[model samples]
Target: MLDATTITAPIFIEDMEVGLTRHLEKIISDHDISLFAEVSEDRNPVHLNDEYAESTMFGGRIAHGMLTAALISAVIGEQLPGHGTVYLRQSMAFLAPVRPGDLVRAEVEVKSIDLRRSRVTLDTRCLVDETRVLHGEALVLAPSRG
Candidate 1:
């Protein structure tokens, strides 16, 4: 957990100019996949059976799109515009498949800010190497000074 006291300076319009970057290297663990599968109840063979996955066009087990999208939440909750940030909406497009061993990274840039309204617009994307796996825009309510 981050120390709030360390963040002594008030977040302002100028602070929005700084974008945050993160590299997520943990391979999607089997336990994580199993939990997601049970929760979503999506027993797609490509996700569950390695033998079946080898027969598919993807040629291997692929992670769920929603699972990849969840990285966006981590970026918001743990990284930039963190803690007090409230999500207004998110629009995303999945461009490629994500296999278990592939490392996915989420990058977010503050596109616009409405200080009076306490809203911020972010351009977000998840990528594997140079190939984009998912891209989107997120609208979030920035914390207001009381």
Candidate 2:
């Protein structure tokens, strides 16, 4: 159901390898949180209101888990199986809070490939200052080059 604009130059099934990996780094910001809230319509108080968030276990505002997860999407779409990779499934565990100003590094590593179906499974994780804040796996449909 993705529109034409979303697809990019595919890496193709043959071009991918089992050990392929990619990483992207970003600093969580208030603006990023606000935009994510607006776009995703997930206006949780813990992600926006500092005072309210202070009352929670997080002690202060934290970014949406999905925002950090989206970095995995960015790696899949723009790096490893660059461009035409279509995400089929993703399972993530939020291990730690991602607060604003926290520099996060998202990483994806190819775990296995189903050549017949052009499917790829990858291990995904995100770290903030060397602490693993998230971990998961992803399934994607890679585009065919030919």
Scored by lDDT, the top model is 2
RMSD of each: 3.6, 3.6
Model 1: worst 10 consecutive residues (lDDT sum): 1-10
Off by over 4 Å in 1: 1-14, 18-25
User: How do the predictions measure up, each by TM-score?
Assistant: 0.83, 0.90
lDDT of model 1 at residue 57?
A: 93
How does model 1 score by TM-score? 0.83
lDDT of 1 by residue, 1-146 (tens): 23545443334443676354433444576676778899999889888899999999999889988888888876775566776778899999999998887878877778888887888888889988889999999998866664
Predictions in order: lDDT: 0.77, 0.90
lDDT of predicted model 1: 0.77
Worst 10 residues of 2 by lDDT: 1-10
